[model samples]
Target chain A: RAHSNPFSDHQLEYPEKPADMDWSKLYPYYYDENTKEMTKKVTITDIGCGFGGLLIDLSPEFPNDLILGMEIRVQVTNYVEDRIIALRTNNVETKGYQNINVLRGNAMKFLPNFFEKGQLSKMFFCFPDPHFKQRKHKARIITNTLLSEYAYVLKEGGIIYTITDVEDLHIWMAKHLEEHPLFERLDETWESNDKCVQIMRHATEEGKKVERKKGDKFVACFKRLPTPEII
Target chain B: MSLIHPIQDIVSSEDGSLIFGIIKNEVVVFRVEEGKSQLVGKWVDELDRNEVIREKVEKEQARQIAENITKKRKTNDESAKTIESENKTAKIPTPGLGAPTVYSHLRNVTLSHGEKLLIICADSDKSVIIFDIDNDNKENVLQLKKRQPYPKRPNAIAISDDDKLIVIADKFGDVYTMSVDSDVKKIDGNVEPVLGHVSMLTSIVVVKDSENKKYIITADRDEHIKVTHYPQTYIVKHWLFGHNEFISSLSVPQWNKTNDLLLSAGGDRYLYLWNWGKNELLSKFNYEKLIDKYITDAHLASERFQNEENNLREYCVSKIVSLPSNRLVAFFVEATPLLIILKYSPEDNTLKLFQTMEFAFNIITMNVNNNQLLITLDNHESQNKDFIKILDFNENTDRFSTNESLSNNLDTTIASTLIEDKTSHIGSTGIYPLYTTINLKKHGESYS
Candidate 1:
């Protein structure tokens, strides 16, 4: 009964195992550290982790940390799985590190559900869609309302890293972060101290795409300030 | 040696000499010798330092003296009243043949028709004051105009080739285009008002196509690359969709006669080259990629990443300029200002990068003239004086390299020679120094 596939009983069922899915090959890093317990050093959620390029690159940097790549599409998730299997790395945690996993959900809505109050230590929005129109302001990933949610999910001293090639969006993100009382701007020195800015600029896949094209990339870092002690 | 201090302003003289405005209200002149810069003059005081201090002190002292005399005369007899009035009149400094001690706080400067230098100063109560530097008559040389009700403070101004029109775009999306031909200045025309973009309009370029059609290309905070045809029709032909951020700077490449190319630099860290005629995207280059390559080299790549990681850079390409041989150069502001040269291949319709200029400081603006790439470095970031450097691109190698054998470098020699040769041929008034820098430390506080 436990081994019985859940989808087999349904009329229109997904394949018993997704076609061509070699589970052993998909998660090589999982078994490599079988003796080691996953440490929750820093819980990071990468929104729109396209192809898991960032998640894969970051795994080695923070072996003890738990990292999650939130992606919308199944195809991309499978591709990321194949990439993780091909690498066969360890210490690098991923749910997909046991610590790191990919969730299939829309980031704009699912962020609150996955993250408890002050649950995330770091969040990265690398080159999020820039809805140019004023009417589409609500759709922007970094908005006043979204910042409040991000403020809620991010722990006191938690950081949000954003990078974009668009000058307008850079200003937009900077404005929102600067305006929000719960967050504070990080100076150049603070930005340099954090490895996330460095990684987002060069190591990330979006960063690579912009670099190949000789594009301008604007970066901003904000820290979620501790909410005033409830008097 | 290292740009002498941050350059405050750089002006080109009639004889092709380069004069820089420095921090202490001093002008430094550099004589172009061979290929390098020969320091002809350093700290040439534009304003009499001693006199400036003395006048300020004297004015305050005289006010005190006048008040004292007035009080004493009132207490004593009325005989000292005549002497008091005389003393008050005497304290006022008389205008003479000597240069004015007051330093000009140049807010904005532009080239006017008849090859005259027109400088607009912020000192005249934020009024649009124009100065004719070349004119001998001091009377009415500087005319103050009433400040227009602009949506946002203007960042810069651009004059048409004919100098018949002046356009100013504020930090907000409001753009005012006026015909300065009349004495009574009014907003005869303007670009269509755009909202939702609260950031300042960074740059404005007036492009005259091959067919003599005039188009105004403006970059705004909303990341909109808007093009409006002249004469109030305000028809936006097409919107450039590449940049995801605010457009910082825009330039219409004049390197080729046939191609109408628009180069744009955005906060997004990409340089975009768009063909205005066809409304087609030409090329895009990133700055971070260049920096990554420089950092993660053959020696460092292995040590930097335990597992062999890709040694590729992602860049925010800040500025772009088209060269004479159908080539374009881009400048990036990241760890340092990285310059990359790319050739536009007609056969493939692609831009292939060929060379790079590794230098310190963020490159704010760049222009190509007489086979020299003139760049303005962001001195404010480095807490140094601003500088305008003319770099010569090696045609053979497509790189910017100094010739070891020459005293000066190739760019200086070429620029000086070109100016000398062209001045004799055209008999035109000296080429107006093309670059200006604002002291952010000094003026930044006021703006904030």
Candidate 2:
């Protein structure tokens, strides 16, 4: 139903800026008295994190780093929240998987509001809405306008990861990321060795669906280029 | 079953006979007579009792259940008969308006006057509820005395010790004060900005000076604390400045043995004690010193993630309560599992960090009554497992500890030494039926 509406309102509710956002409620575990501030930034974010299989797998691997999943669907977000709460409760003694959280947010519109400039280290767009029609391309997760917002939040040497079974969406994401002056394409070796890429390729429900269908997965990786130094 | 909302604020009567807690949509009063806690009275919004809305909501839910039953019946013949019978007899209690529609942000203040207890709570929906819990009656009953709506949503509320005046702080960085008997008036052109901050005000505290002059102390997100003359809010007494981050909590503790002091803690890792009357900084306690020794059981996502960067993890001081004999107990969220006790010496103007007590769960709110420390845990998991733990302070050890013997006794719901209530029970008397079958049928007709 959401994908069929090409002209649906894109505006979303967001905080004015990162300072106005209460990060403590989102990542309570990272708050400490010594620093007197939110110590951990959400270094990695998965846009349209459907079913959150990728986040569930990646949370333990990067136990120190904060990971966030942003999903637009309300029920999907609720499911993720319950899942995380269950995981946290079951592992309270060991304090396992306390680093990941999910929020119901329109990542395409509110990316800048949630993240400070140069705040993010990695961003993922896995099996996002293809929005195949030329007129509906703007609804696709990756776009030229959204890439600039992504670049503003991503730190220098940060990575933007994209993978999809649909070649159209993969090409759309790669073209937008490559066309943006602030990003550079990463070679195949970087994609092969990166632990995150491996998980993204196999962990998500979409990845599993593609595997069941015997479809090919197109993966693209891009690095956020540092700004040029002035003389 | 009643809808379970997390306890936001906890307040105890001065005589320690009663405790009032503001849950999501209602204020629950627990009577503590002879060391037994019992749910006596509750205050909920008027909208929660609108029968027309309740009928509509219930009908809709029942219709959906019926549809699901029919669909399942068609698929599985054996299971269909049991499902149909359950649907026919099982009544879906319409907890529509009974449960808070919007997650509410509530700040509560309680006052004791003779035999009556006055509790004021400000909700994010711009409604201020004043409830009177009268103990003079046979059973303590809670009555909604006043419900006032304002243009701006109030975030913090304070009642005078004498129970004469009520002051409310709103999200727009403004404070309004009026007699408890009178209604809150709208902000007009003639009204002067007496108690206000440039940023969102986090806390408002009322304290009477040595000369009996009433004063209001307010703290804001921008780290500014202002002391103003009460009633005549335009008269600025002093601005306490020095906090580098948002001031989340402000406490004015008066000890019979020592001078009255203002304690403020927030995003800045330091807890600053001030003499609000003189607007002078008395002492600052650096929390960084206690991190290594006290915070051993920190639940962080990553072991590699350092606790502090340059020196700020954005830890906030959520609660602070003062005890007798110049002692204090502070609950710091994101800082440690241990509650820090501090001692202040007026003569030397030195603040000594005393004992740190550990709790099993992450504490959300705490209140001190006599020698009992009542604490509410952050309930992010099972709502039915909420417990209010009571810990006794020992003078000999100079430390606070819970009775391990009583913690094992968990039969009662709300009265046990460790009070546990099923907050998520929808069929409980606390819920309001916000829906009905006829209304649901009408709603279904409109949609189809």
Best-matching candidate per lDDT = 2
Name the regions of candidate 2 deviating beyond 4 angstroms.
Answer: A1-231, B1-6, B46-101, B113-115, B136-140, B183-193, B256-260, B292-313, B334-336, B379-386, B404-411, B415-448
TM agreement with the true structure for every prediction? 0.42, 0.50
| Alpha-carbon shift of residue B180 in model 2 (angstroms) | 0.9
Off by over 4 Å in 1: A1-231, B1-5, B8-115, B118-129, B133-151, B180-199, B293-317, B324-326, B360-365, B376-388, B395-398, B402-448
| lDDT over C-alpha atoms for residue B341 of model 2 | 75
| Residue range A1-231, candidate 2, lDDT tens digits | 233222222323456456667777767878886876888778899988878899999999998889999987767878999999999899999888788989877675456557777889989898888876653555667766456557767888999999998887887788777877678999999888999999999999999989999999999999988855311
Q: How would you encode candidate 2's per-residue C-alpha lDDT over B1-448 as one tens digit per residue?
A: 2335445567777666677776655566776665555667665543533343455467666776777778987787577667556644334355466585543344555555443646565544466766666665545477667767654667677878777767878765667776667765654323433445534667888887766777888876655676766665534454576775667778877573333578888766688888778767888988777755544433332333335543322245666777744456465544345577788766876568777766665566777776677676554344435445666777787677874433222113343322344432333343322111111110011111
Model 1: per-residue lDDT, tens digit, B41-97?
A: 332223343454465567667766777778877799675666556643334455577
True contacts kept of 2: 0.00
Determine which window of 10 residues in candidate 2 chain B has minimal summed lDDT. Answer: B435-444
- For every candidate in turn, the CA RMSD to the true structure comes to 21.4, 19.6
Q: Per candidate, chain B TM-score?
A: 0.57, 0.72
